[model samples]
Target: MRITSKVLITLLIVVAITACFSLITHLSNESQPVGDEIPARILISQTPLSTPLFVAKKLGLFKLHGIDITLIPCNGGVECMSMMTHGKAQYATISESVAMFNSFRDTDFSIISTFVTSDDDLKLLALPRRGFTSIRDLKGKSIGVIKSSASEFYLDSLLLASGMKPTDIERVYLKPDKLIQMMKIGKVDAISSWEPWGYRAQATMDVVNLGFQGMYTLSFNLATMNRKDETSHERSKRILAALQQAITWIQDHPEKAKAIVSDTLNIENNQLDWMWRDYVFRLSMTNVLLANLQLQARWALEHNLVEGKQPDLRSILDRSALQAMQDEVVGQ
Candidate 1:
């Protein structure tokens, strides 16, 4: 009887210990952060506009927010958008102009958020020795621009603003680096492109800035495939959150942020200093962005850049991620 009682007591104690261990393990697993099991690839351009992404990756903010990000480098937003469209990356950083041009043909992706905005990012650089000292000199001259890009749009806008038409110049379509090279070799009289290409052109060759600042406001945005599933929605939120944190850190530490951007882009610190003040870094979907898209769409249609009737621009925006975080998503 004594042995039986002792065995029964020992069994009960063992069962209690095992139960406690199981409960603790279950709670521990439940308390762990979710969403790090899968790695996410984001296509980013080698520009200061993508500073937040660089900062976020460098500081491990993505991991802090439960996401693993692999940054894929691209030449420009157009390339990044293309890579994202082909399923090469889960996300891409693009300018609003890229989104606008694509919205005419496809609704396969959505602009998740606009992380940065700058009016002076796109510049019209001219070769002074080629008798191109002013914006007006671009007339009848070969101008290098990236077709279907903010570079093209800004060039057109600059020309229009300067009382010249798009047809006034010979449009030399080329990649950003090629444009810079063409400018260096005097192959093109002027090149309208975004920084750091613009900065690179000035740094490498004797180029003059035509000084058409504030002609266009370029929004650097995040884009993902148009997925409305729960998984996609959650993933978007995680990315935005990580970016928001990065933006905050950037605002708090401007010098450090600039250093990070300079290092990431392999550009000189002076280049960043020249354009740092032009950029407004934050996470928002504002009325201004919507209106800019509408304006760009109108420009595209007027210029025959897109043939069909303007697709509903609002449909291309996925604000659920921004809204989920209680962030300000103004103007739909």
Candidate 2:
């Protein structure tokens, strides 16, 4: 075919437009960022038990996983859930059973992973003035707890094992630090608390020993998230990955972990050592943990903390990401 000047001009213009469009597309693609810097806000309670998370964050583990983690410190797990409900944080490290039972009682709040499993670190503290030697002697007396917090379950379990029902004692709800003050003022007979508070009560109040739930049952420690849309799924996985690495690093480096915890939580070196020795920092979601969680769920039901309905354990916990991590390590 013979090409006319008009046809040649038109072809040239079309080709120019196509080239320009391609260039624009390429420029646009180049302008957009490639790195994903999704910020992960984590809710933590101020205590030795929850200090490792802060240690991990401060040490840049979360950043290693491509997450910008913001640690939101709260009083306890119950307050942490409030932060989760109000969209204050993406993920939270709290008591697995406490969060689950509360969710069962109210909304269906679910936790993703169980980081710290053992509850052997918890202490049943009695003020020196109370003259309480054991759980039996503490019957019919007031016991301070965080109300719907993890310590509440600990208190309940302690009472149950001691042949005392919940109705046998007057339950008092107070913050960790306040519990120590209340006990000092003779407001309550005993208090069930974790780490620093128990440690403080022993030091400040010179409290008498009741008993400890040592290696008793694996209570949920951290890695709890609300059941949201898929928008947070990948983010959740990444956050867990960071946390898993942090826990593993702590396990591998106990001296470093102890120093970090002591500095972060403002506890003495010996106290930090006690916490490290008492609690297992293993982040595995093992069968033993699952069994204990189920038992906790059942206990919630029995104690009317879950009402008539029970939380579907499978739906509440997503262990795929955790399982994958385990598999990857084992495969390596």
Candidate 3:
């Protein structure tokens, strides 16, 4: 039968619409954004700080599950965060303390999951001029810090323990790496920083160590996002699961774990090992940590860090995904 021009046009239009629908369905079904198929680009700091996540990616854990992670070199956590905030990247690793402090202050971000934290990681180093051995000696002395960041809060906690307020001592804001040089030149009386800086000072300058661990009650390096809801939650779960696997491997095969980290960070095996021991990963969150976070929120509220209203503590944390992953990990 000969088809009319009108029918031919209508049939063509129907075919085009059907084809478009089919293509969209196929793409949606096949494009797994969670697991390893994530399209979100990730940026990490240049330092060895993000070694575990790097190890997970290098080991094919991310790819095996379909995660497409783009690792960009950044100067530090704050820099990585800037990349995320500016839309240069989707996610970045940062200390939970930083996120909490910022969130308290109504900063624009949400916590995805936690990374590594330990009691042995932070140290307070004294300059040669001050000859400070205890937190008390830090009184009236200028201490270098990564101000308004997690590092600052860690130092504040240390000071508070010593009966000193933030106003009691002058804090000089500097990058972690520059503190040592500043100390050598008498630019600052002391420095509070994490390893490499902590270890570097001990090895190079014999910087007196005051009794303080970078350890906080709830230390977490979270995967952050500006978006919230099911999709982000699912992605966060996959990332946390991958992190948990990496942590488990680190615990079971300490030497091999060191090698993985060393390779990822491009650090010497010995240095990696030293750094490895300093980190503790329990892969568990607790009420105590929640309480601490609430305390942090309260502090921010009291100090006007957050907006006029405070956020719900329970709503801020989505630990259900982590719990499910933990169950699976434990089962295996």
Candidate 4:
């Protein structure tokens, strides 16, 4: 009887141990995406403002987070957002205004985290040779702006604040880089844009800021396709964590960050020096952000930039990934 009881006890213990092992295996598989098996492709805007992600990639922070990422470099956030919107990429860094405009289509993308913020980033660069010194002076004069991007919204705000209607000036829709050329040749009297294009205008035509987006900050955010799966949630957290970690590295090592950006973007260190301090990189989402997005959407709607209904500002924000980051930091 004692021998039989021992054999039965050993069998029960073995079965319990096998079940525990199986449970752990299942969890390990479900908790995170198999990085070796599947890689996440993200779209990165090839701008100095995207220095953190670049630093992260250079330092292998993404890999440290167990994520395999393939970055597709784009000229601007709008371009980045376009690729992500079409499912060509899983993630993107898009400007707040561009993201707001794209949200009208209800794409798979959602704003997961804000990358950078600046009060005087977006400015109306007026050619000094044309006697355009102030925002109000640009009235009734031709103003070159990039349509359907932040440039468009910023121009509208400037016009509104000056109590001038859009029709009061010749709204010459042009690409940001082209705006500088247009001003140089006297095609437009003023141009509303964001750097480094704004800086380009200043250098070439000696353009001075007639106005700044002080009240409406020029912000950039990181976004990804919205997915409800646990694996997706974990992956998003991992990406943010990697980026957050990189931001610390950037703040700690500005010269190293600048060198990486200069090599990657082909920007001269001298050129970067002027606009470097304008940017503040961080991961944040606040009520002010929400209000800015909503206001931007309304501006797009009123300006006929988009048709039909507006998107829910709250719906576009998925902070679970950010919350996960907070938990991890506190845990550490």
Candidate 5:
């Protein structure tokens, strides 16, 4: 009886200790703040326009906001949006024009915020050898552009501003890299593209800037699918918070931010300096974005770029995440 009692007492004590240990562990876990465990894959184009995103990743701001981000680099926003659409990524850093173009077909994604804007990002570069020294020189000339992209829109806008129409020029639809190569070989007289392609073309070839400016403002925006779930909304808010931090950091530390961009993009300091002047990095949903979308939609309709009625431009914006951050969603 004595031995049995001793054994029972040992078993009881073991059970009590195990229970106490488990309880302690459970309580400890409950007390600890959640770390950076929220995984997000953001498709980013390799361009200076994505400076804030580059800053966020370089400075680990995303993790600080409880987001584990994997930035997948692509050639441009067009490809980034395509990858996001195919579910290869959960988010994309795309130009608003790309979103506008896609809105005509499927309003599957919603623009979360416009993180950066620039009036001079897009330019008309002409090969002087091709007798293309001005915007008027583009008439009846072969111009390389990424069809259905901001490149095309910029080209058309420049043409309209020059009192010309799209029908007057031969648009050689090509990817950005191909456009550069085609221009070098004299296949295209001019290329309507955004930086750093324009910067790149100038570096590699003798090209003349057509001096087109202020025809359109390009905005780099964060876009994701229209997910209405609370969890998704929370995740988006976290992302916006991180990006907002990055934007603040960039503004406060311009030189450091420029260095980060220069190193990450492998762009020369002079090149960075050249393009950095035009970038206005911030988080906002202003009348500027709205007006641009409406104009693009009308242009798309007029040009038969997309079939059917115009997409309600306002519907494609999901400002819940921005609103959560008290972001500057102006004129909405």
Candidate 6:
């Protein structure tokens, strides 16, 4: 009887220990991304910024990294950042300025990487008949700009760069896509915008490049909402890893990469060729980018673009996912 009671007690203890471990294992599995899990959602702007993302989707790079992506196409970075701001989407491809502007409202957001720098991507085009061949020529002419966008601010930068003030020129507000058509018809003397609209306008309208001053280039960045969940963090790292790989593939195969972007967007050959030169794609956030962000933030503040009194540079750059990915690569 004594032996029977001891055996039963020992069996009960073993069963309890096994059950505890089993429960732990189950919870652990639930926290990690499953191989057959649904695709992670990312809001992407329809621009060169999303070219690599499209390539990744086409090449199955995201799936290779165990991150199936569902891309929600947005017209511009403002809309893209809005999705992140509302928590409707966790990730987006946005302009450094757009991200910087929105970061004022939410500290939970961060720019993980700056993937492209535009040199001459932001261009100033003049109507050929206007004979406005330089930025100085636009001193008193009305310029078309997309209000509430980098277009408007960049026009200010262009003017300031040329020793002119915003007050020196009248600003005509127009959407980026419509700027070209309006300019072609003489609606505005000059238009300031980013590619491929800039490229498209120059080509279609016999417009002259007043300035390819995209030298003070607007950069495009990958941003996300920083979540506390381990799963979310893990997924973010995977997304970056996949993007890094896609960028590598893009560099090594320029023609192929262009084809991917062109085909996806159904772009004309000339437009694709011309606009492609303006983009320099890579993954990084440099001092130049930081400085640009700061400058733009101040511009936004002065323009009443944000409610915050000042910019928060720290909140804008949450590199935790980037650092985590680097550590993982090192570990591997």
User: Candidate 5 on 133-239: residue-level lDDT in tens?
Assistant: 67887778898999788898888888888899889999888988798889888898888899998889889888898857777888999999888887788788888
Better of 3 and 4 by TM-score: 4
lDDT of each: 0.87, 0.71, 0.68, 0.81, 0.86, 0.78
Question: On a 0 to 1 TM-score scale, where does candidate 3 land against the true structure?
Answer: 0.77
Candidates sorted by lDDT, best first: 1, 5, 4, 6, 2, 3
Q: What is the TM-score of each candidate against the true structure?
A: 0.87, 0.81, 0.77, 0.85, 0.87, 0.83
Pairs that clash in candidate 1:
none
lDDT of 6: 0.78
Poorest 10 consecutive residues by lDDT, candidate 6 = 29-38
lDDT of 4 by residue, 278-315 (tens): 78999998887889889988888887889889878788
Candidate 3 on 1-332: residue-level lDDT in tens? 99999999999999999999999988775333443366557777755567667777767656644556677877667667767877888777766556665564445565555566667667777854456668887778898888556667678778778888878888899986688899888888888777667767777766677755544643556556557576666666677777776777667877887776666666677666666666766565567556767777776666454576666655556566677677765774
Error of 6 at 43 (Å): 1.8
What is every candidate's alpha-carbon RMSD to the true fold?
Answer: 8.8, 11.9, 12.8, 9.1, 11.0, 11.1
lDDT of 1 by residue, 1-332 (tens): 25698899999999999999999998775345555545789999988999999999998878877887789999999999998999999899999999999998898899989999998998888878878778887778898999999998888888888889888999999988798888787788888898888878878878888957788889999999887677788778888878887898999999999999888878888999989999999888888888989999999999998889998889888888988865432421
Residue-level lDDT for 118 in candidate 5: 89
**Per the 3 Å backbone cut-off, how many clashing residue pairs does candidate 1 have?**
0
Select the stronger candidate by lDDT from 2 and 6. Answer: 6
Instruction: Estimate, for each residue in 138-239, the C-alpha lDDT of model 2 and write its tens digit.
Output: 778998887666677777877777778889888898877788888788898888777677667776657875766563554545554554565466566666
By TM-score, how accurate is candidate 6?
Answer: 0.83
**Candidate 1 at residue 199, lDDT?**
79
lDDT of 3 at 11: 100
